[model samples]
Target: MTQRHDIRLGADIGGTFTDIALDVRGRLFSTKVLTDYAAPEQAILDGIDIVIRDAGIAPGDIGIVIHGTTLATNALIERRGAKTALVTTEGFRDVIEMRTENRFEQYDLDLVLPRPLIPREDRFAVRGRIDAQGRELQPLDEAALEVLADVIAERGFGAVAIGFIHSYMNPAHEQRARDILAGRLSIPISISAEVSPQMREFERFNTVCANAYVRPQMADYLSRLQVRLKEMGAGCPVFMIHSGGGLISVETASEFPVRLVESGPAGGAIFAADIARRFGLERVVSYDMGGTTAKICLIEDYQPHTARTFEVARTYRFCKGSGMPISIPVIEMIEIGAGGGSIAWVDAMGRIQAGPESAASEPGPACYQRGGERPAITDADLVLGKLDPDNFAGGKIRLSLDNAGAAIARDVGDRLALSPEAAAFGIVEVVDENMANAARVHAVENGKNISENTMIAFGGAAPLHAARLCEKLGVERCLVPQGAGVGSAIGFLKAPFGYEALASKIMGLSKFDAGTVNAMLDDLKATAEGFVRAGTDGAIVREITAFMRYAGQGWEIPVTLPDRAFAAADTAMFETAFKQRYARFFGRAVEGPEIEFVTWSVKAQDVRPEGERFVLETDGAAVAVPARRGVFDPASGTVLETAIVPRDTLCPGARVAGPAVIVERETSTVVTSPFDAVIQVDGTILLVRKGR
Candidate 1:
């Protein structure tokens, strides 16, 4: 095992900012910088240098570095990945195009479904047939792989994804094809059996195709990042955070890069979960609004709820089936194209709308003077006095109020016949409402209530808009954790080193075969252990899981297996537990039909994160006030003078009322008309709805 004294680092790259954190004995230091999407590694190195300096440590003293990024997500959204191809069994070339057959907008006949990741021309099929029971009905032809490899290479493709029929049940054929294609092409390969070992050919195949599409780009960037870190005298073992709220080695991340799609937002969810645990809160909603997007995730009972599938790079706003599906264990959340940098525009109907298109960092906003002419949410916030022009990004970058107001006035105000300030408020309110609507839909779909969940707000822009969001959701309280500006980076430290392995197999409880179940479980254990061994050196690991199902009738809810593998004698116990879980999810369980298991999952995790907790110093009380600022309030329908209080001045138990501003070095949290906040024991400010 590695020594406990080694220092660990974590970095998260977002659309608007790149965040970095250093954890030495569980004490975290962090920093945020503008993301360099053109050369993403540069921002990573810069943030690393800042964080290492903040920790007062030499770069060479660092031991392990874990990174999380939205790069793959962004690349898919912006269409910047390598040209890729998908090879599948004959007659299944249109599987991705066919999709789920459910229309996102059932009423609109003209609605265009999202385009497939691989075009029709890029899709090739081979002759092979595997049945549902892992039986090969038609033998795989060895000659086809060579022909496909030549055609794939001739097209100058960078990566290829192979997803044959029933590969999830038996991967032998896919493995054979991969071996045959190894020497014929230099491109990377992704097999559905390894990427998503589940039923549903459309989703599994899409997941593998997405992974292959982004592998080459992710690998090249990671290699350059490693070299740059070493050049700066840091010889740390780099780690990457996966979307499942766990950490894995960078080498594993480079191979299966699709898992990193929601990696940044996943880190934020972990941070929120940790905060919930510390404060003893049972239900919390993590709100992370960075430069280009805002993410909302629900955490309950000190852990975030995870999903087996996620959609990436959706074309339409708030549409679920509008994106390609990736089958992996992910901390389920809802994301929207509403953030500080989301561009605002006046539509043909003259209705002002905030984005699903971001200006990004290079040409951030009109206020940044980086050649951006479009009006953005941040520009509007500055125009309405919600943001301090001089204190933006800890005063590292100055905002131009004239440019912001002028852009909003010319772009939106002129069309709506309103003043720039009114237009700016409209933009802010519309974006907030968009985010609020997304949150409500997500919660409703997951069989949850938004009002019952506590809101944990982070990211550079979240603190500024969190109180408003809480009001919109009817949430009683909100938590703004310390270092909220670089929330995802801090979240990286809170994550555990782990991996999830899954497989789909048919099993009927009526004729339950203990041997088959045990064998399948063993195979899953071996796969998880193989990944863990590559990342950690003899670390203690535990396997846990549940069987997936629909309630009652023919399916069973996920019943957790015992620590040891299943035995023939335990079949009755398993059935009893499944009945209880089924009743819990749905009101009751049916007694007549036989229960079936569609798929099973196994997750391996370390005993703890890479360090021991260190005691932190708590602040006493502040003795001074900053100043006052007049801010426009929509609730009041006018501008009012509001007191500005620095966050550092408030101590634990100190209370602040609404119509006040709590400013910090990195960002500000606004206490609005009906909200009041009190500092908690752990230095987190808890904002609760108050009776005025």
Candidate 2:
């Protein structure tokens, strides 16, 4: 027997919309509201009110609240975080600015780089020296930190970040500096030893600085949100989803806000993985396209790929090393500024450019008619007749076709010497190509071929272009799951309470130190379990991975370790594991090279529920069509009559041919000529190529 008292709520705030989902026992209710940048929590509150009301539940009945947001990522990209100061080891104040000294783009002589978050004037160094082996060569200068605290206070800094050299090996210096500074200054402090605790001084330092930069803002917002929720009678325990696709206590989220950078997209990836698992699918591609960006992630064996480090706000969208790297557990994916509100234009070379930029929600696409004059992807879709002007957002928002055409004519059509319809088609095609290129690159990087993987498309704009994306990628099938528009929010509701802890200590396989390594792993495992226990008393599963590399190699590949204690005799097993994992990428490993372990990670999470298999009700009678409309056909470069069918009217196994529009309350899916759609038992719209 199930109790109705276990009510859970989820909120996901993206670049454009704030989605809210309420799981009352087993039934789910959701709503979407435009994100209010000025007071982002207001949108969450508004959406929450709607969903809980529609669910026929009072706020007091909600026992848990889970949230994920893109505010940290946006602030880092826009350089709008709090006034921050950084404390570093003596003579290394510029390590973040220096970066790794490797040029990702070798040919560009005048390439610009991302600016460091903390400027030189605000970065102060204390006399402290710690060796890579955790030896304190020079004691931290307490008096110098006192002076630096005055300087920080004089500059009115809201937060301070401490990143001493070799802190990942030993954090004593950073911890002392933080204590001394805390005694003198009244501001939040973030230490690399606590935030990242990983090797690589530059990435570790920048990550702490980033965590400090956004800590104040996130703390304030979270505080107010708690108060508002309490007022609304939903004063339950509030948790946050991190970029690693794990739930954490709000306290942890406020302390290391940088972990939330890719939180929203992480949820989307989790959603796709859950969908794949529900249908027993193995190879899956998760595509999430919202108003401001699109994210592509690969899922294998019912899990989204995980990364120990990821870049944020890349100057070059596809360039690997062009952004600020943060060492943290994160969902591996590629994000591009190609989405519904991506502005379309003709670049200097007269080539059509979609974007690494967006209009966002406020002053959104021109067709939104909220003061935007630029042509965006949504406007192009409208001009191309793919979107309904009068029935947009379930008639909640009335789109303007005139605005869409005018903006397209001015920005793209005129420059290309083409009609608005032609320009719309071109814009849509260009954006589609951009997304496809991202997908292809991501696939190759992951040693995958997308032609064999099924695409799970979601978010507000994904289904709108998913069919075409499939065509471009040569993917035979794409599934737009139920509540696709609020997919990430729904994912949050289903996510497990988990956390990851990392530690770095260089060791060789020849002298395997199992005792020392096991001690470290024990501490990390306990840390992860503490976080998971904060959410529930369910059984916890633990996974350990080591970053191993051939001695003298610049990088290491993650190797999953088998559960149980390691012994001296396990050295051969270690070598075999490294070679096998290495061969998967480089075709073969270099034999006889000394192997070393650089970093170790431990993840702990609750056991996930197994989804029940469902069969489509194919025996149902034929469903009725809702309406009919004219949609632009890119194949013919002209408007063609399209059947407008309400998604509710399409029950399980209901089939609809191409050149149709399936309308739902949140978003619409355009079934192109090359594909046909069938409704699954779980309300997923499965689009398969015709005659396949």
Candidate 3:
């Protein structure tokens, strides 16, 4: 009864690689190619070509194509976007510069925060003002805007951002400014009223600026990709994944490109949730380590945790509140600059230091021998004999062990007076610890204890490092899902066509206006449904979310409304629900304090198919045999002969005493002494405590 014409394709473009997947009736096929930063769409086409050929399906058979990429995020971080300008209220031209004045690191007297994207000269203020109660205090000046438009035209800015103070509460002034600019210039304009209608001026302004900054670039790329796909005989609808784990129309993505900053990682979270659902896992931590970055996220009850805002390119790789924050619904996660291509070096203290910077794929690590002379994490893994040089990347790219040794010896061994092997071990250990530290911090911040949660590791580099991370985080089990190397791309196949719309309105619960609130909710619901319908074929949409809050809660918590709209009788119900969620999070809802709704969000999603459950193995065991290899264990402080086993040879329920290595095709797992390892029913390696 099933037709082959309904195949779905998904792709995730990262800094180092582009992963592609095709799913036909729940069966999946995937492939990977080096990301062509110069022309990213070329990489997508190449990978798609391979996958479709492998699946033996015609391009026209594809019904839908879903994509997630870090192109916007990379453009923001690397400052490689369109030349853009910002328009704001006359008195608040520097709001982006005057970010929240709190120092995330208080003890350091001199701390450097991230610089605002818009420079002082590019920030021009238009005459306008709005109150917190959706009232326009001063009308937007038309004559002033005419002069500003000429100035912008002279500068030839590609895009413009308008973020008047309190515009979130009252968008009239911002909308008027946008209209003036639209007529005067041929460039796209982003208004804070729609981009981030939240009470926080700093976050709202940043979001608008980011959207403007990347709009031109995203538009160009998506247009070209559409043309290319059509030429390839593919007539499928193209949808882009948003940071909130939902698919949006390509047009929407181009308009608000900032929403795509965490798009790739969001897909990985969705993939982990799918795996968790298949096995009935209640709590899981998804770990995805690629070549340039490692991302960690928490999933509770098969849903990735979501946040109203996310930071990009933190100066301190693992520190929160140290980067630019954009107000968008994103899957909450922590990312560190520790990954496969992270450079390894000896610091002034003669200790090994792994990165917050990457060599990337061009020259890549020393083992790649693509003209790179620097030692890197991948090089270290090769030096330790953990990676098969000839079999790297399924032998698509050969590795050079000599090049790795030479780079490590010259850069690290010479300074530390240690052998290359020892230096490689040091780099590996430090990077693993950095990843573990990030995991620990993210868990604590989210009120989670990782010891009880199963670790689902994916991406090309994760399985290689999962066991070590588990040891550091005190986790007992690790699962490498099928097609783990291209996990995020696979995740795109599991996401629903969805979109979220938010607006800022100052409303007090004590004096709630039901009619006004109902109208606003109705507008947002329709907006979300319009987006979902554009990319999906007559799929039904489901609405979900909640209010965001503080302790007396002058600001309200983002509360999830029931499936129905606000009823005249439900005002009290809304208040009660808000109070209960507030108390549950903070332990107490202060009495007699008024609560205000800062923002309201409405999300619309298309229902997806249920995944089949796979059984766990308890009786079948892995045939364990240990081959010896010299490895430097930090705990022992010396090189020792360690036992190694082939990962595939191990059957479910097979136990291996640790101080062992489990090698697979793409990656390896290391089990240290005092921790015993077993193959779980789902083909994942479970390392648990044993009587040593």
Predicted structure with the largest lDDT when compared to the true one: 2
Off by over 4 Å in 1: 3-6, 537-543, 550-557, 609-624
Q: Candidate 1: lDDT of 131? A: 96
- All candidates' TM-scores? 0.95, 0.98, 0.94
lDDT tens digits by residue: candidate 3, 1-692: 11122588999998778889899776777877888988999999998888888888888989888999999998999998889899998988888998988788888788997889999999998777787777878888989998889999999899999998887767888888888888999999999988888778898999999999999999999999999999999887788999999989889999989989999999999999998898788999999999889999999999998888889988876677899898998999999888898888877887788887788887789888788999989998888766778777767789999999999999998888889887888888899998988988898887778788989998888877787788788887677776788899989988888888877776666667778877888888898888887865655666556564533444455677787656568767777777788776678776676666657778888778786886543233445475778755544666667777877677667877767777764456666664667777666666565642
Between 1 and 3, whose lDDT is larger?
A: 1
**Model 2 TM-score, all chains together:** 0.98
Q: Write the per-residue lDDT of candidate 1 for residues 280-366, one digit (tens) a residue.
A: 778888999988999998898888878889888787777888887888989999999988899999888888899889988979999
lDDT of 2 by residue, 1-692 (tens): 11123688889988888989888878888888989999999999999889888998888888888999999999899998999999899899899999998888999999888899988988887898999999999988989888888888888899999999999988999888889889989899999999999999888999999999999999999999999999888878899999999999999999999999999999999999989988888999999999999999999998999998999989987998899998899999999999898999999999889977788888999999899999999999998777888877767789999999999999989998999988999999999999999999999998899889999999989999999999989999889999998999999988888999999999999978999998999899988998888787878899989999999999999999986788888999999999999999899989878999999999999887777776533233345666778898765667888888988777787888888889888889999988888888888988988777
Q: What CA RMSD would candidate 1 show?
A: 2.7
Better of 2 and 3 by lDDT: 2
Q: Select the stronger candidate by TM-score from 2 and 3.
A: 2
Provide the overall lDDT of each model, using Cα atoms, as 2-decimal numbers. Answer: 0.83, 0.89, 0.83
